[model samples]
Target: MSRREKDQLHLARINFLNLIGQSNPSDAWKLFCLVTPNITEEQVDDQAETSSKLTLTTIPPDVVEMIVRTIDIESEKNVRLTAKYLKQIVDARDTMINRVHIHLCSQTVGIEVHEVTKEEPETYSFNVSVIPGVNHIDNAVKKFEEIISKPNTKINHLKIDWVRSEENRASYDELLKSLAVSLADFVEKVHVEELTIDVNAVEHLENLICSLKPDILKRLYVIGPPTCGNDKFDFSNIVILPQWKHLSAFTSSCCELICPIHHLYHISNLRIKMASTSPIDIVGYRDTLIVSQQRIDHEITISHDMENTKQMLEPYIDCSRLTTCRGYYIRSNEKRLTFELKHNKIIFSTMQFLM
Candidate 1:
């Protein structure tokens, strides 16, 4: 026997004696015999006679069930393929799945799991991509249906991303609707995270959000270029259900924000695009809303309010751009600065109270 094999045999024998001592005495003695090379032919014959009938059911109930759940699902699958010990690990209970990624780029729908317990939480930018590939649509969808429909699983995070092109948008929307329908059927009430989707139609997006378990969604981001010949989805029909206890961020392409100030301001962050020359109605109302837009508000100045004024700038940053109390145009290529908003304008300054 190889050194590794001998070591494993020794370890198994110890585990057999420790946990399976009294109840599984038969297994205990057989393991002891494997570790002891000097065992008699009588014992070998007895083991041979009984080994064929020994089933995994003979193991203790708890020992038979080993819950191995994680964000690194691929690694678990690979290990299970090689080790019987791992194959015996069940996917059902005692598992805490912090993030669930449904990778759509590959031909096969990839279900990746990373093992994280309740005490530690992990984060990821939820994205869904459907690049042209050798993907079999019907088979892939079926596989995804099977994975998401797995019983006895509590998914805390879920997202699928889809890229948009004028030619593929309508088709893409249909696929997204189908996927959302499937998810709603399986996914129950749970906390949601960053979901990057292409929302070509408002009704589809609204229906998908409504399907999710209410009140626990933390963040849902709608990203991608505008669809329908640069026309934006009218956000008039969008309604915030009472169940969305934690729904905050909702940013979509060219989508307008209108009534329901309570829910509107509840959105602490949003990214908007400048579609027209007319000024957007975002300047007056202030409710701790952080707005990010493609157009830099020339009227707004960024103020630096750090305790130490000079600490705001990096060592390599040009000091010429720094001002005592004036708003400067921010170019992302130059340097990133800490900023706050005052009077509906972005403010950045050093050695002065900004707001």
Candidate 2:
């Protein structure tokens, strides 16, 4: 035999012996006779029948169920592949999935599902290759449904990443559209808690966010590619969605938001991008926080000139109170709102009190 084969056989023999020692002692001698190479043909024939009875399928159902319950999702999937009875046992149980991430590439769609247990978190990856050969979109959707559509599966977070390249641009867009449609169909069933998407197309992002069940989704994040001057994205439709209106936390990174700033005032935690923040916008933000009873924290990253923005807000700077080099405060009654301008970021915080 080859060196690798011999090493593997040696390891297997040691493992079988150790397992036999820990378990029932009566089967040890029988298994020992089966493993020993020097045993005669007649001896092998005698133990063949006994060894057949030791197959994994012969394990008691309750014991098999207990074993499958303790393993991670991937291990449970492997156990199901080993035998039909094991598959049945695993399918009967429900598993808690912590996160599901879908990555859309030019030639392939990748899926990552995570399961958290007492020991550690377990991750499972599934990739559907669309490299110009097979049924592209249909095959990908089929594989996606197979993995995420498991009965009684609960997912806490869902993230879709669109990483399209210039080479296969057309195919990538089609795949993304198909997947987004498929995702919209099952938004209610998954009960996704937090959704973070990196989409290049504004329409797709709006559609995806609007499709989410409003009552179930609480956190939303939109991460777009970096943009230059005068290139702003329209999120007018997104702000109107019930899902967006009810979001407890919202984050928009790298892309300049063109809509009115008032649409974001209700979110408890907000991180958004604006091409420019006018003096009127700043005053409105401060006024909203002052009379509000709810807690609020906001971080606005500006793409315009920092000096110009500071000069514009100079008139409204509450100079009567103590002011630092780059820090400005806007206070009303007992509530004090602070605005800190550092490089391209504008941070705003409010001290809220009960009436």
Candidate 3:
């Protein structure tokens, strides 16, 4: 601020405090308006409509933001309620908040707050008890909506954990619906992380998960038996099928799926608790053309050591269709890389792929 602004602000504070200490809120607000006389919102909109050319710097946006950031969170709402000028600051788009966690419970909604320190990852939690008529999720979302309406506000990570309660199934589902909708426009949606939940939301998770764009979803984990004796919840309906187009990874305790041959390009990993009990033929392309020096017919598999395995896979990658080292017949494709661990060697051949 310039010398004139600094002096005016100092004098305004002194006079404002005197009136406020005398228990005159109205006079204090009036004195505030006298000092920071602002043009009406209608006038701002009118100018924008009247002018086709307007650079971002036309308004000192940075300075306005710096002035608004001086208000503390606890007092921000009060300041908004007190004066029209302060309300504009609160309404400004760009949430200064960086992190938020919502914990959904049967009878309470808890918000987890992590401190600025990163060493121990210390966290503190505040909870709002569920009210009978009011929806917990809707109420919780109010804070988010108020801040996120700003064009620049970002929600870093939204971690929602649901503990199933039969008595609160309806409410739990409601919570999921609200969260899914509110986060529809969320940025940074592609972050991958393990998520474990068994709740009312599980019953229709497929639709909710599919509603988001392909890249918005991350790795997923589906645990069985979210509710008491409800172990029969169909994991296949939710995760095993190719529902969300390109979810990076999916793990389910109670479901197993024939890895989608055509959709392998979209999925990174599909693991089932029962997969070990069955043959693991992941990313197999029966008719896929093997691409090497030439377009040759071969199969592919995943391997940790593609270098050492290269000796075994050269014929396959080269479309030789025969293992030069072991003299074993091999089949392959350019679209699929198949890895097989046998006799301490990486093998790509199977009975079906052998010519």
Q: Which candidate is the best by TM-score?
A: 2
228-270, model 2: which lDDT tens digit per residue? 3443367767778777777889898877776677888888888
- The digit string of per-residue lDDT tens for model 1 on 1-355 reads 5677545544432343333345466865664444344446474444444332123323334533232121133332322222234323333333335566544442233445443443443332222337564334444455556544544344556655544445555546656677666667754633344455556666676666765656666666665543344233544455556434465555554343232333444444534432332233333322122233222212222132333333332232333434332323234444233344333233332222333
Question: Model 2 clash pairs?
Answer: none
Q: By lDDT, who's the top model here?
A: 2
lDDT of 3 at 176: 67
What lDDT would each prediction earn against the true structure? 0.43, 0.60, 0.43
Q: Backbone clash tally for model 1? A: 21
TM-score of 3: 0.41
Q: Model 2 compared with the native: what TM-score?
A: 0.59
The local lDDT score (0 to 100) that residue 338 gets in candidate 3 is 44
lDDT of 3 by residue, 1-355 (tens): 5666544444333322332333356764564454434434353334334422112222134623443355344433323223344335334534333344556666666665432222233233324445576655677766545444555443334455566566767766776677567656566332323344444435555544643345545556665442323334434455444445556565555343323334433445554333222233322332232322222222223223434544533444343333333323233432344444332233433333333
Question: How many clashes in each candidate?
Answer: 21, 0, 17
Against the correct fold, how does model 1 do in TM-score? 0.44
TM values, all candidates: 0.44, 0.59, 0.41
